[model samples]
Each structure stands twice: as C-alpha cells, then as structure tokens.
Target: MTVTDDPVRQQASREATRWLILLQEESDDPEISAEFDAWLAAASVNREAWAQTEKAMGLVARLSPGNTSSWCDSTGGGVDMLRQPRRRIPKRAAWTGSVVALAACVALFFTAPSLLLRLRADAMTGTAETRVLHMADGSEVTLAPGSAVSINNKDGRRSVTLLAGEALFSVVHDPAHPFVVKTGNFTTTDIGTVFDVRRTESGVDVAVRSGRVQVSGGSILAQGRELGAGGGLTASVAGFHADERSAEQVGVWADGLLVANDEPLGQVVARLKPYLSGMVIVPSHLSSQRVSGVYSLTDPGRALEAVVQARQGSVHRYSRWLTILR
Candidate 1:
C-alpha cells in the first residue's frame, strides 16, 4: 500500500524522513548517530520506517540524472516540495521523485499534528486580544494575543500545555497538587509563583514575576533552572540567556506596552507578529539590528513605524494584514 493510503504508515514515513534528513545533515556528528541508533532501537516501527526511507533513497539514487525531472513531473510533484531550503543537493544530480515524496511526507508530519491540536485547544485568543481565564482551582492565566492553551486537572494533578503563543500564569499555591506548564520540550513547575511563558521560533522564554519556578527539559537552556522574581530566561537554538527585569515589566504587553532591552530586531518583530492582523516581514539585513525601548502594543502599526524609524529603516504597508520592513 502507498504511504498516503494509511495515516499510521504516513506518520511513520514522515518521522523516518525527518531522521534521514537529520542523519544526512549531521553525518559528521557522532552524537546524532548515537541518538539515531537509539531511536531505531526504541521501536520495531522505527526500523521499518527507516528501511522504507532507505529504499526510497536507493530508488532515487538509481535514477539517471537526465530523467529525474521527468519522473517528478510525471508524478505531479516538484523539487520545491522539500521544506528544507538550506538542504544542499549535489551539483551533478537532478530533482527526483524519491526526494520530493520524502519531503512531502516530512512536511505533513510537522504541520498536521500542530494544526489539529491548535484547533482543539480549550482556550485561545485571536490577534491583539488578551483573555483572562479563572480556573476551577483558583489559578488565573492571562493569555496573550494569538496564544492557545489547554488545561487538565485529572486525578488531583494540574497540568497546562501552552499550545501556541504567550501567556502569564498566576498559579495558586497548591502543594498537594503541583501545577506544571509545558511548552515544546521544556516544562515549568510553579513554586507558588506568577510567571510568563512565551514560545519562540528557537525555543521558549520564561520570565518569573513573583515566587519561583523549576524548569526542566532536554533543551540545555531550560534544564534545571530555578528562577525567582525579576529573573528571566530566554532559551533558543543558539543557547540560553538569564536576565533580570522587574516583575511588572515581564508581561507588560498585557498592559498595551512592548518592552525590549537590547533585543535583536528580528526577535522584536517576532514578538510583534502575533498582535498584528497582517504579516510583518523584516529583511535579513535589518533583522540583526539591536533595539531597546518601550512601544505601545495597542497600536502595533505605529509601534512598528517607530521601530523602523529608529533603525533608519523604512516600512511599507500593503494592507491591514501585510507589511514589509526593509
């Protein structure tokens, strides 16, 4: 049967494609190979998936270079199906169906689950809208614009999953029932405190406003950090940064304020992206510029204008939902 014909098989194929790409990209890294070995040994399905992926790769490798494009076109697929733009192809080889099919599988694997989860989240906010939720356990959570969260209080356990965006959590002190907030691979356990959690492209940002929190995860940045009031951590692909800021300033966005301290323009733009109904594009050149200031989140357009002007840059507005900064 074709991979697409069975959802379970399709998911397995997508996961296999991800591992194959990772192994190929990091072939020189022994750690990655070890991890891949562990993954392969974890389940029989994993081994089967890898075998299927290998067969697909072999099929592409056997194709004559001149006929690769013809094969892809005949299948109504293209080289662009691959989402990894940075992936390099050898100079002599042409686009083939194996690579395109694997890419399609991997792309679906990444997007489908997240989309389904977001649609099923218990609480969610749209662009520029903040929502305050009062839980049955007396805990309060303030969701930022474009954020989504799900709560579970089962068998005397309190758990919250940050599905998307940012939120400020004021968890009630319940020593008998520990409150845990999860985002990506990291988890934050409240030690009777108030904190803000934001999901970024690289990782998660956690800022403590009151009390303390224990953070643990596979990510090096957040593993085993006890953050107290006025303390913050930004975890990203590059690494982690621990900083100090006032508790009131941690989630000032809820008060119509955007605060930044020597933050990259790209990151600042990312923070602003949620509040905006339209897309905000920052060119790579301008993305690296440093910004530090307080802007009005209530009027994101004006705030964006001020940011561009401060960097001696320009903003082009295409519509209410589309903007470009260069």
Candidate 2:
C-alpha cells in the first residue's frame, strides 16, 4: 500500500513532519527540554515520530547536513534520506515493503542516505538579483547577478551545472560521494571543499580555498587539470595553468570579504565587478599594475578609494560605473 494511504505509515509521516519542525526549533533553542517532554506526552506517537524523524535526520546529518528535505518517506518504510523523492510506497505490498525498507534503511541509515544531502536546483537569476544557495553538504553558493545554474543529484554523485555567469561553492566533505561542478567549458570535482568559478569574456577562471579540486575541460576541450589548496587557474580554448592569486580572489565573496594580494589592478576591478553598483574599469596602462590588501565587499566604494590612495590611481565615476587610471 502507498505510505500515505496506509494507517501506520500515515501516522509515521505525520509524526515525522511534526518532529522536523520541532527539531528546527530545538536547533535554534536548545533549552526546550521541558517543552520536548510535554510534546512527547501529547501522544505516544510523538515519541515514535521523534524516533523515526531522528533516524532520518541523523542519516542526513551523517551524509550531508545541507539538503535535509529529500528524506521524506511516506510509505512507512523506515526513513532513509535520498537525493530524490522516494518512490511511491506500493499498496498491496505494504507489509513486505516496510520490512525490506526498514532493513535497507538501517543499513543505509548508518552513513546518512545520500539522498537528502544532495540538492536539485534549476534556477535563473536576473540582472538585479543575487542568488544565494545552501547545498545539502553544508556548503554555501552565491550566484553573481544575472547568473543561472542547474543542480542535479544522481545515484553516485552530486553535480552543479552553471549555465551562465559566476558561482561560488563552499562544499562539505563526504568521502563517499565526490562533488562535481561544471561551467560552459570547465568541470571541477571535489571530495570536499570551497571554490569559485567564473566565466570571463576570454575564458574560465577558477579559484580554490579549502581542500582541493580537479579541473578538466568539460565538453569544450579534451583534457582537465587538477588544482590543490590555495591554487588558482585561468583557461581559455587555448590552455590552462597554475595561478596563485586568482584562487584567493574568487573566494572573496563567500564571507562578504575581498582581498587582492599583489594582484593586477585590472584583475581586482574584474573581481570587484559583481559587488559594486556599476562597472569598474581600470585603464590599460594600470591593467598590469599589482595591488595588495584586503577590502570589505560591503563597501566597494571604500575599497576602491583605498586602492586609489595606495596605488596612486585616479578614480572616475560615471553614472553607476567607475573607472580607474594610474
């Protein structure tokens, strides 16, 4: 029988939903023990519900703490967090399915089912909107203005396909499944870590923060390269290589922080483009000039001002955009 239609399974689903809300509340307020006690007393099913939810949620926690929504099991089968929605619980075989599901859930539940920890995202961001996403793996992703991405959770892997613009990924570590990120011409994989990928006019730019990543030209090219901690790479149709500063620059948006450690003035302007209100253009003469230091993304104008003062560069504001000249 379908889980929603079965009496016992229906009860479990209802109880699980209630516990989800309770767990979120408890996460926010840890001093609710007495409240929890009262909740448990409200129904004997409350405890059972809590137990089942705990099992499911725990599975998610073990697998990936970010995508908890995928663990709903309506068929009364013991809960196992999955990357996709559970198949409909068959009606005639309810008893058998529940037994088998429970057994499988227990085996899979030990490590947190990979289901609830992966996300399926298909979205587009407009010119004015900046999109922020929390992945199932406890990593955060921020899309630049006017960007789009598609996230897929498959049986063996978690993948993100960036359709346009730039994206930052801070991935949580899971040895069982590797996280893969794809852009127009590039594909990057991570066991667990953070990085940024941007599509530039000429080619793709990749920057790394924590952990390591392997970048291969996706479908566009024949080969890919690996990137280690603090490594950055820039590639076009022509080629790819190791870059030290670019990787660090890509992560600037993750914490609302910005930094340019001895990087070109032009490069810094390119990195700052997303945070500022208008275009930031550095003159060709200063394009190769190196700049260094940390700035706040919250105040790009101040950061711009600092760059001008320290580097003897002049700033010109025209409408919403700004231009810099040495």
Candidate 3:
C-alpha cells in the first residue's frame, strides 16, 4: 500500500528504506546486518516493509550503483551481510557520499534533474549554490542552485543549453552570432536583450529583463514568437502560456531575493534548497499548494518557515542537513 493508504505501513516502509541504505553503505560490517535482522525478527510487518522498500529502491539501482537484491542476504534473498560482514555510525556525523543526496524514492523527490547533467554539464552548482560563467561570445550566465548547463562557444558559436534549474543571461548584443539558450523543447534567442530562463516541472519560462528575444520551437511557438522587456512566456511541448512580468521580478533570485507570485510551494522550496546547507522535504500534497511571498534567498531557514507556515504547515529540522515540511 502507498503511504496515503496506511500510515502504520508507511512508517515501516520508511524504516525499511533507511535500513536498506545503511546496509548497502556498510555491508562490510556485520553489526549492521545483525541489527537489521533483529529489527526484521522483532515484527512480521518489518519483513513486508523490507520487501516493499527493496522494490521501491529498485529504481535507485537504475540511476545509481550498488543497489540490488543482492545488496545482502539479510532478507534471505542474497549474500548474508551478517555472515559476510557493515560500521558504527558516529553520532551527528556528516551524511557524506551516501544516497541521501540524490535519492530516487524518498517522497518521490529528485534534487537534480537527471544523472546525465552530472556528466555533461560544463558548469554546475550544488545545494544553495550559484555560479556565474562568462561565455566565449561575450555573454554571461548566472546559474541558480541545483542548476547545470553546457556551453557551446566553440567555433564562435554562441549557444548554451540549460540542462537544469534556472539561469539569468546577459548578452553582449552580437548580431553576427545570435546568442541562443536551449532548455527542453524551447529555444530562446537573444535579440539584443538580457533575460531569464527557468526550467520548471511543467514547462520552460523565458522572461526578458531588457531588450527583446526571439523564441522559436515546435509548432507550439506560433512561428518563432518574440518577447520584449517585461514579457514572459512559458512553453511546453503541448503548448505555451504568455504572461507579463516586470524585469525586476523576472530573475530577482540573482540578487538573493525570491519574489513568488502565485507559484507552487514546491518550486519555491526547490529554489531555496540550493541556498540552505540541508535538504527540504515537501510531501507531494503540500507541493501543489500555491504561495506568494518575498523572502531572502540568503536566509533559507526563515524563508522556509515563512513559506511552509503560511500554508498551515510546520517546518521540522531534524538536523543541520535535513528539514521536513509537514
């Protein structure tokens, strides 16, 4: 059953997933396997939870390594980790080099867009991190946290592909070579303008801060649409949506400010996540909640409280590295 179907089973599933992760990480140590067996023998529900958790974690194996039914024979399905060998985790230790960073199943949230971005992005930023890159075509790109991009300035070709997250571009107005930014299905070409392109869960958002831009895509773009300053367009494969937004409101995140205007709470948390030195967990239910606010990107904890509390939710910081919104 899903988490919504049974809360008791949900707790078991969560614990099982945690045990699986720990065993995979410390498989060489026998103590972990013994502890896991003890937990499993303590209750029959634990075995069911383990099986369900393993099935769920199977997806992680596709994205990452060392995830398999053979992670151990702890479940009598693979090599016995207790007999073969897992470590004593120090209290309050860092969760470094674990699946906690880019988990695939927990709450069904993926921090980064895709594993491909990790290998392909010429420039990328980690949690709550931002990067500024000067392209070979005299253009500048500001990448938001949890963002990645591949720059193609070779042979004097001014092209950039935003692999993930959001970016603000400042073009040098090189008519000889039109600066282009591509993300998903949308291609935004600078017509002597500065603009912002953000990749969201639904579509790609292109907004001009100054000058104009010619956006061309599939038939959805209506034959190469053009947007001027204060104009914004959100284009997806199915269609596009156009809106008017002030330049100051377009890419204010570059200045450590986030002005959410009826945006989803999930998107806001995704934006601020890069700034905080931790993870923010927003269940799928609360993710759809609409929110509007002006918060400091520099102070994500306070901002997170403001955003979650406004929606009648509470922020619980389990540690410096993890926060859950409920």
Please tell me which predicted candidate would have the highest TM-score against the true structure. 3
lDDT for 168 in candidate 3 is 95
Off by over 4 Å in 3: 1-115, 276-279, 283-285, 319-322
lDDT of 1 by residue, 120-232 (tens): 79988877899999988999999998889988988988999998899999989998889999898888899999999998777789999899998877758444889999998
Query: Model 1: clashing residue pairs?
Result: 278-321
Instruction: Report the number of clashing residue pairs per model.
Output: 1, 12, 11
**Considering summed lDDT, which 10 consecutive residues are worst modelled in model 3?**
61-70
Q: Which candidate number would show the highest lDDT if scored against the true structure?
A: 1
Ranked by lDDT, the better of candidates 1 and 2 is 1
* Cα error, candidate 1, residue 97 (Å): 30
Estimate every model's Cα lDDT from 0 to 1. 0.76, 0.63, 0.75
Candidate 1, residue 180: the lDDT equals 96
Each prediction's TM-score versus the true structure: 0.63, 0.54, 0.65
Q: In model 2, where is the ten-residue run with the lowest total lDDT?
A: 60-69
**Candidate 2 CA-lDDT value:** 0.63
lDDT of 1: 0.76
- Which has the higher TM-score value, candidate number 1 or candidate number 2? 1
